[model samples]
Target: MTLLSSCTRAARISAAVIALLACGSVLLQIGLNLLGGEPLAEALWRMSRFFTILTNLIIAATFAVVAGGRSVAPRWLLAMTAAIAGVGIVYHALLSHLLVQVGAEIIANHGVHTVVPILSVIWFAMFAPVDGLRWRDTWTVVIWPVLYCVYILARGSVTGMYPYPFIDANTLSPVQMAINIAGLTLFFLALGLLLVGMLRLRGRKSAN
Candidate 1:
């Protein structure tokens, strides 16, 4: 097989394995934390408050793209996964102290936010299909995050608990929170374009 094809196959296998490991780490941590405290289902519901968990789910979905091939998964799903992974990495690096926990939590935290992001980026660079992606599609990347923001804010409104400090309307005014959300949306857009650019460059290089 050609070198690119070989690399693509390797990337696919690696993506699937990394995703599985990340999921396992997360589940193990949750099980450990809730061992004597709450039901597994309740613990999982609480854990879903963190965007890191959601991003891991996105990463897990990307595994389908890699394993099942381009025809099986849409390009938008790949773009969304990469966008969230980039956000997860940056957020964890900067705001880890706020979300810090002990023992199994540490493993789950880094597995999803740190390790998964890095490997997902590598997988996308090496294997994500880019032939049909366009700059115009970058806006679609903002849709998921926007909807998530709405959900969290609405949930926080009722529960009086925000997942992240930045999104905590109790501490920050609506205007301030809006600014933060706008900044994050812009960041996602930029990263989405970057991924698209990288994929296009690789596609061109492979074509040549």
Candidate 2:
């Protein structure tokens, strides 16, 4: 019970970090889009990567909390974050970022680019448990991530320019894109619900 009671404050801290990161990323991209000057695309891309990085940091901090015996994650949430980041980690680790390549070719050929891949690796480690590798814990950790994804997707359509390549509706076949977006949306929804559940659990623990 004491252990259960301890997780709430720390958990909220992790969550707040994620919220700020998401908001910051979106705002930065919006600003750069408006500016439309030299180095703007690179700036936008870098700012966008910070959102992903903060998310990864949040995940990392979540695991740190859980492993400290302060929190526990539901099995499904753990599996989902791991599964999603796994694919992303592999691709970014092995392949190249289009922004780095194309933006260089089209705009600034000699500029340095350091954003997506670095954050991808950082977020990939978000689920690591010091006690051991634990896949049963993603609920609390991934909540902000999922919610922000929805916020971004919905907002992106209105503003234009998605954070990443996968969800660009214009680039995909119509049927396929809807299916893709739907699936992604569910994952985000699940993440948000899981976080809410953990907070509820914390409440219950405190009430007792």
Candidate 3:
């Protein structure tokens, strides 16, 4: 096969693997929640509160399409790469010490937060298309996270349950919660810019 064809095949295979890993990890987490006596509806709702779960679900869907030999918009793929990068970085830096897990929970946790993120970023860097990315596309990265912050805050006002400690309404003053959300939004923006920069650098190299 030509090198381009080889890369395309490799990208599709990688996408398939990532899709399976993400989907399986999410299903495993849900099953564990159900087995632990959480009602199915409640379990799913609780999972939706987490950025890790949502981002992984996005990864699963995006990559599944690529694996199916369909083209995804480059901007959407770029946004997803930024979001998942945030999930992994934030989890390791701020949230990793807060959790204790064993057995299947451990697998699910690492699969979504660590394994999927690492693989997704690698796939993007090595194989995913970057020819259409632009600096303005960085804005798209924060759209989902900003909406999620609004959602969790709105839902927490009624339910009094926040998914992450940083955003907990009961525990944090409004000012502090706002600061945390602002910081996270900035982080996502930074990640998005960094990816765009990488694309520009690659483009320059290819032009020479």
Candidate 4:
């Protein structure tokens, strides 16, 4: 096979592996939660509140599509990369020390927060298309995080549960919560713009 075609095939294989890792990790976590006596519905609901779970699921879906040889929008890929990157960064930087895990939980945690995020970003940098990315596309990356903040805050207002401590409404004041959300939003935007900038630079080098 030609080199380009061979690379494409290899990329598809890598995508499939990443997809399986993400899906399996998420499923394992859910199973563990159920085994730990969390009601199935409640476990699912609580898991959904976590940005790690949601972002991993998004990564799984996006890679699954690529593995199936389907095209993904460049902007969507950019958003996914940024979101997953944030998942890894925020986990390691802010949350890693707050929790203790063993066995399957350790596997699940690393899969979503470490392994998958690193692999996804590498995959994007190496294989994903970015031919038409724009500065405005960076804004799209924050949409998911913004909506998540709104949803979690709204639900926390009634349920008194939060997935992450930083934005926990019960402990944090209104202004503090807003500040946390804004900071996270800016972080996501910065990641997106950074990815776009790298891609632009790569394109320039290719043209030279």
Model 2 per-residue lDDT tens digits across residues 94-113 = 33445443332322111111
lDDT of 3 by residue, 102-170 (tens): 999999999999999999888887775556777987899998899999988999899998989989999
**Better-scoring candidate (lDDT), 2 or 4:** 4
What total of clashing residue pairs does each candidate reach?
0, 0, 0, 0
Query: Which stretches in model 1 have alpha-carbon errors above 4 Å?
Result: 1-8, 68-70, 99-102
Give, for candidate 4, the lowest lDDT window spanning 10 residues: 1-10
State the local distance difference test value for candidate 3: 0.87
**Which is the better candidate, 1 or 3, if ranked by lDDT?**
3
Ten residues in sequence with the least summed lDDT for candidate 1: 1-10
- The alpha-carbon RMSD values of the candidates against the true structure, listed in the order shown, are 3.6, 10.4, 3.1, 3.3
Candidate-wise lDDT, in order: 0.71, 0.44, 0.87, 0.87
**Candidate 3 Cα deviation (angstroms), residue 114:** 0.4
Tens digits of per-residue lDDT, candidate 1, 35-67, equal 758888888877787777776776676575555
How well does candidate 4 match the true structure in TM-score terms? 0.92
User: Clashing pairs in model 2?
Assistant: none
lDDT of 1: 0.71
